[model samples]
Target chain A: MAKLKNPRGLEDSQVMKMSYWKILSILLLVYTVTGGFLMEVPRLAIVNETIRSLYFHVPMWFGMVVMFLTSTLYAVRYLKKPGAYFDIISVEFANTGLIFGFLGIVTGMIWANYTWGTPWHGDPKQNGAAVALLIYCAYFVLRGSLENSEQRARLSAVYNIFAFAAMIPLIFIIPRLTSSMHPGSGGNPGFNTYDLDRNMRMVFYPAVIGWILLGVWIATVRIRLRNIEDKILELEYEKNH
Target chain B: MKRIISIAASLGITFTGYAQEPEMADGMRSEGKIYVVVAILAVILFGLVAYLISIDRKVTKLEQRLNDGKPR
Candidate 1:
Protein backbone atom coordinates (compact mmCIF):
# COMPACT_ATOMS: atom_id res chain seq x y z
CA MET A 1 0.00 0.00 0.00
CA ALA A 2 1.24 3.49 -0.85
CA LYS A 3 1.92 5.64 2.20
CA LEU A 4 -0.67 8.34 1.74
CA LYS A 5 -0.03 11.65 3.46
CA ASN A 6 -2.95 13.33 5.17
CA PRO A 7 -3.45 17.11 5.29
CA ARG A 8 -4.28 16.72 9.01
CA GLY A 9 -0.78 15.21 9.50
CA LEU A 10 -1.90 11.94 11.04
CA GLU A 11 0.97 9.46 11.33
CA ASP A 12 1.01 6.49 8.99
CA SER A 13 0.43 4.09 11.86
CA GLN A 14 -2.82 5.74 12.95
CA VAL A 15 -4.04 6.34 9.39
CA MET A 16 -3.21 2.87 8.13
CA LYS A 17 -4.62 1.08 11.17
CA MET A 18 -8.17 2.11 10.20
CA SER A 19 -7.77 1.94 6.43
CA TYR A 20 -8.60 -1.57 5.19
CA TRP A 21 -11.03 -2.92 7.79
CA LYS A 22 -13.06 0.29 7.79
CA ILE A 23 -13.40 0.22 4.03
CA LEU A 24 -14.28 -3.48 4.14
CA SER A 25 -16.91 -2.83 6.78
CA ILE A 26 -18.59 -0.16 4.68
CA LEU A 27 -18.51 -2.23 1.51
CA LEU A 28 -19.86 -5.38 3.17
CA LEU A 29 -22.71 -3.47 4.81
CA VAL A 30 -23.69 -1.78 1.59
CA TYR A 31 -23.72 -5.18 -0.07
CA THR A 32 -25.72 -6.58 2.84
CA VAL A 33 -28.40 -3.94 2.50
CA THR A 34 -28.80 -4.63 -1.19
CA GLY A 35 -28.27 -8.38 -1.40
CA GLY A 36 -30.19 -9.13 1.78
CA PHE A 37 -33.37 -7.85 0.20
CA LEU A 38 -33.02 -8.89 -3.40
CA MET A 39 -31.69 -12.40 -2.79
CA GLU A 40 -33.88 -15.49 -2.99
CA VAL A 41 -35.31 -16.69 0.32
CA PRO A 42 -37.18 -19.74 1.52
CA ARG A 43 -40.90 -19.10 1.50
CA LEU A 44 -42.59 -20.27 4.64
CA ALA A 45 -46.07 -19.46 5.91
CA ILE A 46 -45.68 -17.40 9.09
CA VAL A 47 -42.21 -16.12 8.37
CA ASN A 48 -43.03 -15.13 4.77
CA GLU A 49 -41.06 -12.09 3.71
CA THR A 50 -39.90 -11.51 7.25
CA ILE A 51 -37.31 -14.23 6.64
CA ARG A 52 -35.41 -11.33 5.15
CA SER A 53 -34.99 -10.04 8.69
CA LEU A 54 -32.62 -12.94 9.36
CA TYR A 55 -29.96 -10.97 7.50
CA PHE A 56 -30.39 -7.85 9.61
CA HIS A 57 -31.66 -9.06 12.99
CA VAL A 58 -29.57 -12.17 13.62
CA PRO A 59 -26.35 -10.28 12.88
CA MET A 60 -26.97 -8.06 15.89
CA TRP A 61 -26.78 -11.05 18.23
CA PHE A 62 -23.75 -12.44 16.42
CA GLY A 63 -22.05 -9.06 16.71
CA MET A 64 -22.99 -8.85 20.38
CA VAL A 65 -21.57 -12.26 21.16
CA VAL A 66 -18.36 -11.49 19.29
CA MET A 67 -18.02 -8.16 21.09
CA PHE A 68 -18.59 -9.73 24.47
CA LEU A 69 -16.13 -12.50 23.68
CA THR A 70 -13.54 -9.91 22.71
CA SER A 71 -14.29 -7.98 25.88
CA THR A 72 -13.86 -11.07 28.02
CA LEU A 73 -10.53 -11.94 26.41
CA TYR A 74 -9.28 -8.44 27.12
CA ALA A 75 -10.64 -8.66 30.64
CA VAL A 76 -8.60 -11.79 31.15
CA ARG A 77 -5.59 -10.00 29.76
CA TYR A 78 -6.15 -7.19 32.27
CA LEU A 79 -6.30 -9.73 35.07
CA LYS A 80 -3.07 -11.35 33.89
CA LYS A 81 -1.33 -7.99 33.48
CA PRO A 82 -2.78 -4.92 35.12
CA GLY A 83 -2.76 -1.87 32.87
CA ALA A 84 -4.97 1.11 32.10
CA TYR A 85 -4.93 0.47 28.36
CA PHE A 86 -6.18 -3.10 28.72
CA ASP A 87 -8.85 -1.95 31.15
CA ILE A 88 -10.03 0.73 28.74
CA ILE A 89 -10.09 -1.72 25.87
CA SER A 90 -12.08 -4.20 27.91
CA VAL A 91 -14.63 -1.65 29.04
CA GLU A 92 -15.10 -0.14 25.59
CA PHE A 93 -15.63 -3.56 24.02
CA ALA A 94 -18.22 -4.42 26.65
CA ASN A 95 -19.95 -1.08 26.10
CA THR A 96 -20.18 -1.75 22.39
CA GLY A 97 -21.38 -5.26 23.13
CA LEU A 98 -24.15 -3.86 25.30
CA ILE A 99 -25.28 -1.63 22.46
CA PHE A 100 -25.37 -4.63 20.15
CA GLY A 101 -27.29 -6.64 22.75
CA PHE A 102 -29.87 -3.91 23.09
CA LEU A 103 -30.30 -3.74 19.36
CA GLY A 104 -30.64 -7.52 19.24
CA ILE A 105 -33.40 -7.55 21.84
CA VAL A 106 -35.36 -4.75 20.23
CA THR A 107 -35.10 -6.27 16.79
CA GLY A 108 -35.93 -9.70 18.12
CA MET A 109 -39.04 -8.35 19.74
CA ILE A 110 -40.15 -6.74 16.51
CA TRP A 111 -39.59 -9.93 14.58
CA ALA A 112 -41.31 -11.96 17.25
CA ASN A 113 -44.34 -9.71 17.20
CA TYR A 114 -44.94 -10.29 13.52
CA THR A 115 -44.13 -14.00 13.37
CA TRP A 116 -44.90 -15.30 16.83
CA GLY A 117 -48.01 -13.14 17.36
CA THR A 118 -46.70 -11.44 20.49
CA PRO A 119 -43.76 -9.23 21.36
CA TRP A 120 -42.88 -11.02 24.60
CA HIS A 121 -43.79 -14.68 24.59
CA GLY A 122 -41.86 -15.42 27.76
CA ASP A 123 -39.95 -17.63 25.39
CA PRO A 124 -36.84 -19.19 26.86
CA LYS A 125 -34.48 -17.41 24.52
CA GLN A 126 -36.25 -14.09 25.03
CA ASN A 127 -36.02 -14.31 28.81
CA GLY A 128 -32.50 -15.64 28.60
CA ALA A 129 -31.33 -12.75 26.46
CA ALA A 130 -32.97 -10.22 28.81
CA VAL A 131 -31.30 -11.76 31.84
CA ALA A 132 -27.94 -11.81 30.10
CA LEU A 133 -28.25 -8.13 29.31
CA LEU A 134 -29.09 -7.32 32.92
CA ILE A 135 -26.00 -9.17 34.08
CA TYR A 136 -23.87 -6.95 31.85
CA CYS A 137 -25.82 -3.91 33.00
CA ALA A 138 -24.76 -4.67 36.57
CA TYR A 139 -21.14 -4.71 35.42
CA PHE A 140 -21.40 -1.04 34.45
CA VAL A 141 -23.11 -0.37 37.77
CA LEU A 142 -20.27 -2.07 39.60
CA ARG A 143 -17.74 0.03 37.71
CA GLY A 144 -19.60 3.24 38.52
CA SER A 145 -19.77 2.58 42.25
CA LEU A 146 -16.05 2.05 42.70
CA GLU A 147 -14.07 5.13 43.77
CA ASN A 148 -10.48 3.96 43.20
CA SER A 149 -9.30 3.55 39.63
CA GLU A 150 -7.15 0.50 40.17
CA GLN A 151 -9.73 -1.19 42.32
CA ARG A 152 -12.46 -0.31 39.84
CA ALA A 153 -10.58 -1.73 36.91
CA ARG A 154 -9.56 -4.88 38.73
CA LEU A 155 -13.01 -5.58 40.12
CA SER A 156 -14.82 -4.77 36.89
CA ALA A 157 -12.48 -6.87 34.82
CA VAL A 158 -13.32 -9.80 37.05
CA TYR A 159 -17.00 -8.96 36.79
CA ASN A 160 -16.76 -8.69 33.01
CA ILE A 161 -15.37 -12.21 32.78
CA PHE A 162 -18.15 -13.48 35.01
CA ALA A 163 -20.75 -11.66 32.95
CA PHE A 164 -19.48 -13.18 29.74
CA ALA A 165 -19.54 -16.67 31.24
CA ALA A 166 -23.12 -16.17 32.43
CA MET A 167 -24.16 -14.75 29.06
CA ILE A 168 -23.03 -17.82 27.13
CA PRO A 169 -25.38 -20.15 28.98
CA LEU A 170 -28.23 -17.69 29.14
CA ILE A 171 -28.18 -16.84 25.46
CA PHE A 172 -27.02 -20.08 23.95
CA ILE A 173 -27.09 -23.15 26.12
CA ILE A 174 -30.10 -22.63 28.37
CA PRO A 175 -32.31 -21.59 25.49
CA ARG A 176 -31.48 -24.74 23.61
CA LEU A 177 -32.07 -27.06 26.56
CA THR A 178 -35.78 -26.31 26.71
CA SER A 179 -38.70 -25.38 24.51
CA SER A 180 -38.05 -22.22 22.57
CA MET A 181 -39.99 -20.41 19.91
CA HIS A 182 -36.63 -19.57 18.46
CA PRO A 183 -35.49 -21.91 15.76
CA GLY A 184 -33.01 -24.68 16.57
CA SER A 185 -34.51 -25.18 19.98
CA GLY A 186 -36.64 -27.98 21.42
CA GLY A 187 -36.26 -29.97 18.20
CA ASN A 188 -37.53 -27.10 16.10
CA PRO A 189 -36.08 -26.89 12.64
CA GLY A 190 -33.30 -24.35 12.39
CA PHE A 191 -31.87 -22.41 9.49
CA ASN A 192 -30.01 -25.50 8.39
CA THR A 193 -33.27 -27.36 8.09
CA TYR A 194 -34.69 -25.08 5.43
CA ASP A 195 -33.68 -21.43 5.29
CA LEU A 196 -29.94 -21.76 4.91
CA ASP A 197 -29.82 -21.66 1.19
CA ARG A 198 -26.53 -20.90 -0.54
CA ASN A 199 -27.81 -17.52 -1.67
CA MET A 200 -28.86 -16.51 1.85
CA ARG A 201 -25.53 -17.68 3.25
CA MET A 202 -23.68 -15.38 0.90
CA VAL A 203 -25.40 -12.31 2.33
CA PHE A 204 -25.76 -13.63 5.89
CA TYR A 205 -22.08 -14.34 6.49
CA PRO A 206 -21.02 -10.95 5.14
CA ALA A 207 -23.65 -9.22 7.27
CA VAL A 208 -22.28 -10.89 10.41
CA ILE A 209 -18.73 -9.87 9.56
CA GLY A 210 -19.78 -6.34 8.67
CA TRP A 211 -21.73 -5.83 11.88
CA ILE A 212 -18.95 -7.29 14.02
CA LEU A 213 -16.37 -5.07 12.34
CA LEU A 214 -18.57 -2.04 12.91
CA GLY A 215 -18.88 -2.90 16.61
CA VAL A 216 -15.10 -3.30 16.92
CA TRP A 217 -14.60 -0.06 15.05
CA ILE A 218 -16.86 1.76 17.50
CA ALA A 219 -15.13 0.15 20.48
CA THR A 220 -11.70 1.17 19.20
CA VAL A 221 -12.85 4.76 18.77
CA ARG A 222 -14.09 4.84 22.35
CA ILE A 223 -10.81 3.29 23.52
CA ARG A 224 -8.94 6.09 21.77
CA LEU A 225 -11.11 8.69 23.48
CA ARG A 226 -10.41 7.14 26.87
CA ASN A 227 -6.68 7.11 26.14
CA ILE A 228 -6.79 10.80 25.29
CA GLU A 229 -8.66 11.54 28.48
CA ASP A 230 -6.16 9.55 30.50
CA LYS A 231 -3.24 11.39 28.93
CA ILE A 232 -4.81 14.76 29.71
CA LEU A 233 -5.38 13.72 33.31
CA GLU A 234 -1.82 12.53 33.62
CA LEU A 235 -0.47 15.74 32.17
CA GLU A 236 -2.59 17.81 34.55
CA TYR A 237 -1.44 15.80 37.56
CA GLU A 238 2.20 16.19 36.61
CA LYS A 239 1.82 19.97 36.14
CA ASN A 240 0.03 20.38 39.50
CA HIS A 241 2.68 18.37 41.33
CA MET B 1 -78.36 -12.83 6.37
CA LYS B 2 -75.85 -12.21 9.23
CA ARG B 3 -75.52 -15.94 9.83
CA ILE B 4 -74.82 -16.56 6.13
CA ILE B 5 -72.16 -13.77 6.09
CA SER B 6 -70.41 -15.24 9.19
CA ILE B 7 -70.35 -18.67 7.58
CA ALA B 8 -68.76 -17.22 4.44
CA ALA B 9 -66.09 -15.37 6.43
CA SER B 10 -65.21 -18.49 8.38
CA LEU B 11 -64.89 -20.50 5.18
CA GLY B 12 -62.66 -17.82 3.70
CA ILE B 13 -60.39 -17.97 6.74
CA THR B 14 -60.18 -21.73 6.55
CA PHE B 15 -59.23 -21.61 2.88
CA THR B 16 -56.51 -19.02 3.62
CA GLY B 17 -55.05 -21.41 6.19
CA TYR B 18 -54.56 -24.01 3.48
CA ALA B 19 -53.44 -21.48 0.88
CA GLN B 20 -50.95 -22.92 -1.62
CA GLU B 21 -48.34 -20.20 -1.53
CA PRO B 22 -47.06 -18.23 1.42
CA GLU B 23 -47.71 -14.50 1.50
CA MET B 24 -44.77 -12.27 0.63
CA ALA B 25 -43.98 -8.75 -0.55
CA ASP B 26 -43.81 -9.80 -4.17
CA GLY B 27 -45.99 -6.88 -5.27
CA MET B 28 -43.71 -4.37 -3.61
CA ARG B 29 -40.61 -5.98 -5.12
CA SER B 30 -42.23 -6.18 -8.53
CA GLU B 31 -43.19 -2.50 -8.33
CA GLY B 32 -39.56 -1.70 -7.41
CA LYS B 33 -40.52 -0.16 -4.05
CA ILE B 34 -38.25 -2.61 -2.22
CA TYR B 35 -35.35 -0.86 -3.89
CA VAL B 36 -36.58 2.40 -2.44
CA VAL B 37 -36.54 0.85 1.03
CA VAL B 38 -33.06 -0.54 0.47
CA ALA B 39 -31.83 2.80 -0.87
CA ILE B 40 -33.08 4.73 2.16
CA LEU B 41 -31.53 2.27 4.58
CA ALA B 42 -28.24 2.29 2.64
CA VAL B 43 -28.18 6.09 2.85
CA ILE B 44 -28.63 5.99 6.60
CA LEU B 45 -25.91 3.34 6.97
CA PHE B 46 -23.49 5.42 4.89
CA GLY B 47 -24.28 8.55 6.85
CA LEU B 48 -23.54 6.83 10.16
CA VAL B 49 -20.33 5.30 8.80
CA ALA B 50 -19.20 8.72 7.60
CA TYR B 51 -19.89 10.25 11.00
CA LEU B 52 -17.92 7.48 12.72
CA ILE B 53 -14.98 7.98 10.36
CA SER B 54 -14.94 11.70 11.08
CA ILE B 55 -14.84 11.00 14.82
CA ASP B 56 -12.04 8.52 14.31
CA ARG B 57 -10.06 11.16 12.42
CA LYS B 58 -10.66 13.75 15.13
CA VAL B 59 -9.47 11.30 17.77
CA THR B 60 -6.30 10.64 15.77
CA LYS B 61 -5.68 14.35 15.57
CA LEU B 62 -6.04 14.74 19.32
CA GLU B 63 -3.68 11.83 19.90
CA GLN B 64 -1.12 13.50 17.66
CA ARG B 65 -1.35 16.72 19.65
CA LEU B 66 -0.99 14.87 22.93
CA ASN B 67 2.00 12.90 21.61
CA ASP B 68 3.68 16.20 20.71
CA GLY B 69 3.07 17.39 24.32
CA LYS B 70 1.10 20.31 22.86
CA PRO B 71 -2.26 19.45 24.28
CA ARG B 72 -4.78 22.05 23.25
Candidate 2:
Protein backbone atom coordinates (compact mmCIF):
# COMPACT_ATOMS: atom_id res chain seq x y z
CA MET A 1 0.00 0.00 0.00
CA ALA A 2 1.29 3.43 -1.01
CA LYS A 3 1.30 5.95 1.84
CA LEU A 4 -0.34 9.13 0.68
CA LYS A 5 0.63 12.55 2.02
CA ASN A 6 -2.85 13.81 1.11
CA PRO A 7 -5.69 11.77 2.61
CA ARG A 8 -8.51 13.64 0.88
CA GLY A 9 -10.07 11.55 -1.91
CA LEU A 10 -12.13 14.03 -3.99
CA GLU A 11 -10.51 14.44 -7.39
CA ASP A 12 -12.89 13.22 -10.08
CA SER A 13 -14.47 15.98 -12.18
CA GLN A 14 -17.12 13.59 -13.45
CA VAL A 15 -18.37 12.90 -9.94
CA MET A 16 -18.72 16.61 -9.14
CA LYS A 17 -21.02 17.06 -12.10
CA MET A 18 -24.55 18.22 -11.17
CA SER A 19 -26.56 16.31 -13.76
CA TYR A 20 -25.43 12.79 -13.02
CA TRP A 21 -27.53 11.14 -10.32
CA LYS A 22 -29.75 14.13 -9.48
CA ILE A 23 -31.54 14.43 -12.78
CA LEU A 24 -31.75 10.67 -13.11
CA SER A 25 -33.24 10.39 -9.64
CA ILE A 26 -35.88 13.05 -10.32
CA LEU A 27 -36.82 11.57 -13.70
CA LEU A 28 -37.08 8.09 -12.25
CA LEU A 29 -39.19 9.34 -9.33
CA VAL A 30 -41.55 11.07 -11.71
CA TYR A 31 -41.94 7.96 -13.84
CA THR A 32 -42.18 5.49 -11.00
CA VAL A 33 -44.46 7.42 -8.65
CA THR A 34 -46.89 8.19 -11.47
CA GLY A 35 -46.82 4.86 -13.24
CA GLY A 36 -46.71 2.72 -10.12
CA PHE A 37 -50.04 3.98 -8.76
CA LEU A 38 -51.81 4.50 -12.06
CA MET A 39 -50.82 1.26 -13.80
CA GLU A 40 -53.22 -1.70 -14.04
CA VAL A 41 -52.69 -5.07 -12.33
CA PRO A 42 -54.46 -8.42 -12.31
CA ARG A 43 -56.84 -9.14 -9.42
CA LEU A 44 -55.02 -11.92 -7.68
CA ALA A 45 -56.56 -13.60 -4.61
CA ILE A 46 -55.76 -12.11 -1.18
CA VAL A 47 -53.30 -9.65 -2.75
CA ASN A 48 -55.92 -7.76 -4.78
CA GLU A 49 -55.29 -4.21 -3.59
CA THR A 50 -51.82 -5.08 -2.35
CA ILE A 51 -50.63 -6.23 -5.75
CA ARG A 52 -49.75 -2.59 -6.29
CA SER A 53 -47.21 -3.03 -3.52
CA LEU A 54 -45.15 -4.86 -6.13
CA TYR A 55 -44.17 -1.52 -7.64
CA PHE A 56 -43.25 -0.08 -4.25
CA HIS A 57 -42.21 -3.05 -2.12
CA VAL A 58 -40.79 -5.78 -4.35
CA PRO A 59 -38.49 -3.30 -6.13
CA MET A 60 -36.84 -2.65 -2.77
CA TRP A 61 -35.25 -6.11 -2.86
CA PHE A 62 -34.04 -5.52 -6.38
CA GLY A 63 -32.49 -2.26 -5.23
CA MET A 64 -30.95 -3.93 -2.20
CA VAL A 65 -29.32 -6.74 -4.20
CA VAL A 66 -28.01 -4.34 -6.81
CA MET A 67 -26.51 -2.07 -4.12
CA PHE A 68 -25.03 -5.04 -2.24
CA LEU A 69 -23.41 -6.33 -5.40
CA THR A 70 -22.00 -2.87 -6.00
CA SER A 71 -20.68 -2.86 -2.44
CA THR A 72 -19.08 -6.29 -2.94
CA LEU A 73 -17.41 -5.12 -6.12
CA TYR A 74 -15.95 -2.18 -4.21
CA ALA A 75 -14.87 -4.54 -1.44
CA VAL A 76 -12.92 -6.54 -3.98
CA ARG A 77 -11.38 -3.33 -5.29
CA TYR A 78 -10.45 -2.23 -1.77
CA LEU A 79 -8.74 -5.58 -1.15
CA LYS A 80 -6.69 -5.04 -4.27
CA LYS A 81 -5.90 -1.33 -3.81
CA PRO A 82 -6.22 -0.76 -0.04
CA GLY A 83 -7.37 2.82 -0.73
CA ALA A 84 -9.63 4.89 1.47
CA TYR A 85 -11.57 5.84 -1.68
CA PHE A 86 -12.58 2.25 -2.32
CA ASP A 87 -13.26 1.64 1.37
CA ILE A 88 -15.51 4.70 1.60
CA ILE A 89 -17.39 3.55 -1.50
CA SER A 90 -17.66 -0.01 -0.17
CA VAL A 91 -19.12 1.13 3.16
CA GLU A 92 -21.59 3.60 1.60
CA PHE A 93 -22.88 1.00 -0.85
CA ALA A 94 -23.33 -1.43 2.02
CA ASN A 95 -25.13 1.24 4.02
CA THR A 96 -27.58 2.02 1.21
CA GLY A 97 -28.09 -1.68 0.53
CA LEU A 98 -28.87 -2.34 4.17
CA ILE A 99 -31.51 0.40 4.24
CA PHE A 100 -33.14 -1.04 1.13
CA GLY A 101 -33.04 -4.53 2.57
CA PHE A 102 -34.59 -3.29 5.79
CA LEU A 103 -37.40 -1.66 3.84
CA GLY A 104 -37.87 -4.84 1.82
CA ILE A 105 -38.25 -6.95 4.97
CA VAL A 106 -40.72 -4.51 6.55
CA THR A 107 -42.84 -4.25 3.43
CA GLY A 108 -42.74 -7.98 2.93
CA MET A 109 -43.82 -8.58 6.52
CA ILE A 110 -46.71 -6.15 6.13
CA TRP A 111 -47.75 -7.76 2.86
CA ALA A 112 -47.48 -11.18 4.45
CA ASN A 113 -49.52 -10.14 7.46
CA TYR A 114 -52.46 -9.03 5.37
CA THR A 115 -52.34 -12.00 3.00
CA TRP A 116 -51.02 -14.95 5.06
CA GLY A 117 -52.57 -13.95 8.42
CA THR A 118 -49.14 -13.53 10.03
CA PRO A 119 -46.17 -11.19 9.92
CA TRP A 120 -43.71 -14.09 9.85
CA HIS A 121 -44.66 -17.66 8.93
CA GLY A 122 -41.19 -19.25 8.94
CA ASP A 123 -41.30 -19.45 5.19
CA PRO A 124 -38.03 -20.39 3.50
CA LYS A 125 -37.79 -17.08 1.64
CA GLN A 126 -38.49 -15.01 4.74
CA ASN A 127 -35.97 -16.97 6.82
CA GLY A 128 -33.38 -16.69 4.08
CA ALA A 129 -33.84 -12.93 3.83
CA ALA A 130 -33.55 -12.60 7.60
CA VAL A 131 -30.29 -14.55 7.62
CA ALA A 132 -28.85 -12.48 4.82
CA LEU A 133 -29.61 -9.31 6.78
CA LEU A 134 -28.04 -10.82 9.91
CA ILE A 135 -24.83 -11.49 8.02
CA TYR A 136 -24.56 -7.85 6.90
CA CYS A 137 -25.54 -6.65 10.35
CA ALA A 138 -22.58 -8.60 11.67
CA TYR A 139 -20.37 -6.88 9.09
CA PHE A 140 -21.28 -3.44 10.50
CA VAL A 141 -20.76 -4.67 14.05
CA LEU A 142 -17.33 -5.99 13.04
CA ARG A 143 -16.40 -2.61 11.58
CA GLY A 144 -17.50 -0.81 14.75
CA SER A 145 -15.34 -3.07 16.92
CA LEU A 146 -12.11 -2.27 15.11
CA GLU A 147 -10.15 0.95 15.78
CA ASN A 148 -7.36 0.80 13.24
CA SER A 149 -8.49 2.04 9.79
CA GLU A 150 -6.49 -0.35 7.60
CA GLN A 151 -7.28 -3.36 9.75
CA ARG A 152 -10.96 -2.46 9.81
CA ALA A 153 -11.08 -2.04 6.05
CA ARG A 154 -9.17 -5.25 5.38
CA LEU A 155 -11.20 -7.37 7.76
CA SER A 156 -14.51 -5.84 6.69
CA ALA A 157 -13.68 -6.36 3.04
CA VAL A 158 -13.00 -10.06 3.65
CA TYR A 159 -16.17 -10.44 5.69
CA ASN A 160 -18.16 -8.61 3.05
CA ILE A 161 -17.10 -11.14 0.43
CA PHE A 162 -18.15 -13.98 2.72
CA ALA A 163 -21.45 -12.18 3.41
CA PHE A 164 -22.14 -11.90 -0.29
CA ALA A 165 -21.41 -15.60 -0.71
CA ALA A 166 -23.90 -16.47 2.02
CA MET A 167 -26.48 -14.04 0.56
CA ILE A 168 -26.78 -15.86 -2.77
CA PRO A 169 -27.71 -19.28 -1.44
CA LEU A 170 -29.93 -17.79 1.23
CA ILE A 171 -31.92 -15.57 -1.11
CA PHE A 172 -31.98 -17.67 -4.30
CA ILE A 173 -31.26 -21.34 -3.74
CA ILE A 174 -32.90 -21.99 -0.37
CA PRO A 175 -36.15 -20.35 -1.42
CA ARG A 176 -36.34 -22.68 -4.42
CA LEU A 177 -35.52 -25.78 -2.39
CA THR A 178 -38.54 -25.40 -0.13
CA SER A 179 -42.04 -23.96 0.00
CA SER A 180 -42.22 -20.18 0.09
CA MET A 181 -44.92 -17.53 0.31
CA HIS A 182 -42.88 -15.28 -1.93
CA PRO A 183 -43.82 -15.21 -5.61
CA GLY A 184 -41.44 -16.79 -8.15
CA SER A 185 -40.43 -19.53 -5.74
CA GLY A 186 -41.53 -23.17 -5.28
CA GLY A 187 -44.42 -23.33 -7.80
CA ASN A 188 -45.95 -20.00 -6.78
CA PRO A 189 -47.50 -17.80 -9.44
CA GLY A 190 -44.76 -15.36 -10.29
CA PHE A 191 -43.47 -12.94 -12.89
CA ASN A 192 -41.90 -15.88 -14.64
CA THR A 193 -45.11 -17.91 -14.43
CA TYR A 194 -47.15 -15.25 -16.19
CA ASP A 195 -44.26 -13.09 -17.41
CA LEU A 196 -46.29 -10.25 -15.84
CA ASP A 197 -49.33 -8.65 -17.47
CA ARG A 198 -48.51 -6.14 -20.19
CA ASN A 199 -49.42 -3.01 -18.23
CA MET A 200 -47.87 -4.38 -15.03
CA ARG A 201 -44.59 -5.14 -16.80
CA MET A 202 -44.33 -1.64 -18.21
CA VAL A 203 -44.54 -0.04 -14.78
CA PHE A 204 -42.78 -2.83 -12.86
CA TYR A 205 -39.57 -2.67 -14.89
CA PRO A 206 -39.35 1.11 -14.52
CA ALA A 207 -40.13 0.86 -10.80
CA VAL A 208 -37.19 -1.52 -10.26
CA ILE A 209 -34.84 0.71 -12.23
CA GLY A 210 -36.11 3.81 -10.46
CA TRP A 211 -35.66 2.38 -6.98
CA ILE A 212 -32.17 1.12 -7.81
CA LEU A 213 -31.19 4.52 -9.16
CA LEU A 214 -32.58 6.21 -6.05
CA GLY A 215 -30.44 3.88 -3.94
CA VAL A 216 -27.40 4.91 -5.97
CA TRP A 217 -28.22 8.57 -5.39
CA ILE A 218 -28.39 8.01 -1.65
CA ALA A 219 -25.09 6.12 -1.68
CA THR A 220 -23.34 8.93 -3.53
CA VAL A 221 -24.55 11.51 -1.02
CA ARG A 222 -23.32 9.32 1.83
CA ILE A 223 -19.96 8.87 0.15
CA ARG A 224 -19.63 12.64 -0.22
CA LEU A 225 -20.46 13.22 3.43
CA ARG A 226 -17.94 10.55 4.48
CA ASN A 227 -15.30 12.11 2.26
CA ILE A 228 -15.89 15.44 3.99
CA GLU A 229 -15.52 13.75 7.36
CA ASP A 230 -12.27 12.10 6.32
CA LYS A 231 -10.90 15.44 5.20
CA ILE A 232 -11.85 17.08 8.51
CA LEU A 233 -10.20 14.28 10.48
CA GLU A 234 -7.00 14.56 8.47
CA LEU A 235 -6.87 18.33 8.95
CA GLU A 236 -7.46 17.95 12.67
CA TYR A 237 -4.66 15.38 12.93
CA GLU A 238 -2.26 17.70 11.09
CA LYS A 239 -3.14 20.63 13.35
CA ASN A 240 -2.68 18.70 16.61
CA HIS A 241 0.20 16.33 15.81
CA MET B 1 -58.21 22.45 17.45
CA LYS B 2 -61.06 20.72 19.30
CA ARG B 3 -63.38 21.16 16.36
CA ILE B 4 -60.80 19.79 13.98
CA ILE B 5 -60.13 16.78 16.19
CA SER B 6 -63.86 16.00 16.58
CA ILE B 7 -64.37 16.35 12.85
CA ALA B 8 -61.44 14.03 12.14
CA ALA B 9 -62.76 11.52 14.70
CA SER B 10 -66.21 11.48 13.11
CA LEU B 11 -64.71 11.15 9.63
CA GLY B 12 -62.62 8.18 10.74
CA ILE B 13 -65.60 6.46 12.34
CA THR B 14 -67.82 7.07 9.34
CA PHE B 15 -65.19 5.66 6.94
CA THR B 16 -64.59 2.58 9.07
CA GLY B 17 -68.30 1.74 9.12
CA TYR B 18 -68.34 0.86 5.42
CA ALA B 19 -64.72 -0.24 5.07
CA GLN B 20 -63.93 -3.78 3.92
CA GLU B 21 -60.69 -5.71 4.12
CA PRO B 22 -58.11 -4.80 1.47
CA GLU B 23 -60.24 -2.20 -0.29
CA MET B 24 -59.18 -1.67 -3.89
CA ALA B 25 -60.47 0.03 -7.01
CA ASP B 26 -61.45 -2.02 -10.02
CA GLY B 27 -59.31 -0.18 -12.53
CA MET B 28 -57.81 3.21 -13.39
CA ARG B 29 -60.84 4.64 -15.21
CA SER B 30 -63.45 2.86 -13.08
CA GLU B 31 -63.98 4.21 -9.58
CA GLY B 32 -62.35 7.50 -8.54
CA LYS B 33 -61.07 6.11 -5.21
CA ILE B 34 -57.99 4.78 -6.98
CA TYR B 35 -57.01 8.40 -7.62
CA VAL B 36 -57.14 9.02 -3.87
CA VAL B 37 -54.72 6.15 -3.25
CA VAL B 38 -52.52 7.43 -6.05
CA ALA B 39 -52.55 10.92 -4.57
CA ILE B 40 -51.58 9.63 -1.11
CA LEU B 41 -48.70 7.62 -2.52
CA ALA B 42 -47.52 10.62 -4.54
CA VAL B 43 -47.50 12.82 -1.45
CA ILE B 44 -45.53 10.29 0.57
CA LEU B 45 -42.95 9.68 -2.14
CA PHE B 46 -42.56 13.36 -2.89
CA GLY B 47 -42.08 14.20 0.75
CA LEU B 48 -39.45 11.50 1.15
CA VAL B 49 -37.49 12.49 -1.94
CA ALA B 50 -37.71 16.14 -1.08
CA TYR B 51 -36.38 15.49 2.42
CA LEU B 52 -33.45 13.60 0.96
CA ILE B 53 -32.78 16.46 -1.41
CA SER B 54 -32.73 18.90 1.48
CA ILE B 55 -30.13 16.79 3.28
CA ASP B 56 -28.09 16.60 0.11
CA ARG B 57 -28.15 20.37 -0.17
CA LYS B 58 -27.02 20.82 3.41
CA VAL B 59 -24.15 18.40 2.89
CA THR B 60 -23.18 20.16 -0.31
CA LYS B 61 -23.11 23.48 1.54
CA LEU B 62 -20.85 22.01 4.20
CA GLU B 63 -18.61 20.56 1.52
CA GLN B 64 -18.36 23.92 -0.22
CA ARG B 65 -17.47 25.67 3.05
CA LEU B 66 -14.74 23.11 3.66
CA ASN B 67 -13.38 23.52 0.15
CA ASP B 68 -13.26 27.30 0.52
CA GLY B 69 -11.73 27.00 4.02
CA LYS B 70 -14.14 29.62 5.30
CA PRO B 71 -16.09 29.52 8.56
CA ARG B 72 -19.20 30.78 6.80
Off by over 4 Å in 2: A1-17, A187-190, B1-24, B27-31
- Candidate 2 lDDT at A98 equals 96
Predicted candidate 2 versus true structure: per-residue lDDT over B1-72, tens digit per residue: 233334434554554466543235655448666678668878888888888877776677679668878653
Candidate 1: Cα lDDT at A187: 44
Docking quality level of the chain pair in candidate 1? acceptable
- Candidate 1: tens digits of C-alpha lDDT, residues A125-147: 99999999999999999999999
Top lDDT: which candidate number? Answer: 1
TM-score winner among the candidates? 1
lDDT of 2 by residue, A74-159 (tens): 99999998999999999999999999999999999999898667999888889999999999999999999999999999999999
Candidate 1 versus the native: TM-score?
0.90
For model 1, state the Cα shift of residue A145 in Å: 0.4
Supply the global lDDT for candidate 2: 0.80
> Candidate 1, residues B1-72: lDDT per residue as tens digits?
233334434554554586666667889989999999999999999899989998997888888889976536
TM-score versus the correct structure, for each prediction: 0.90, 0.83
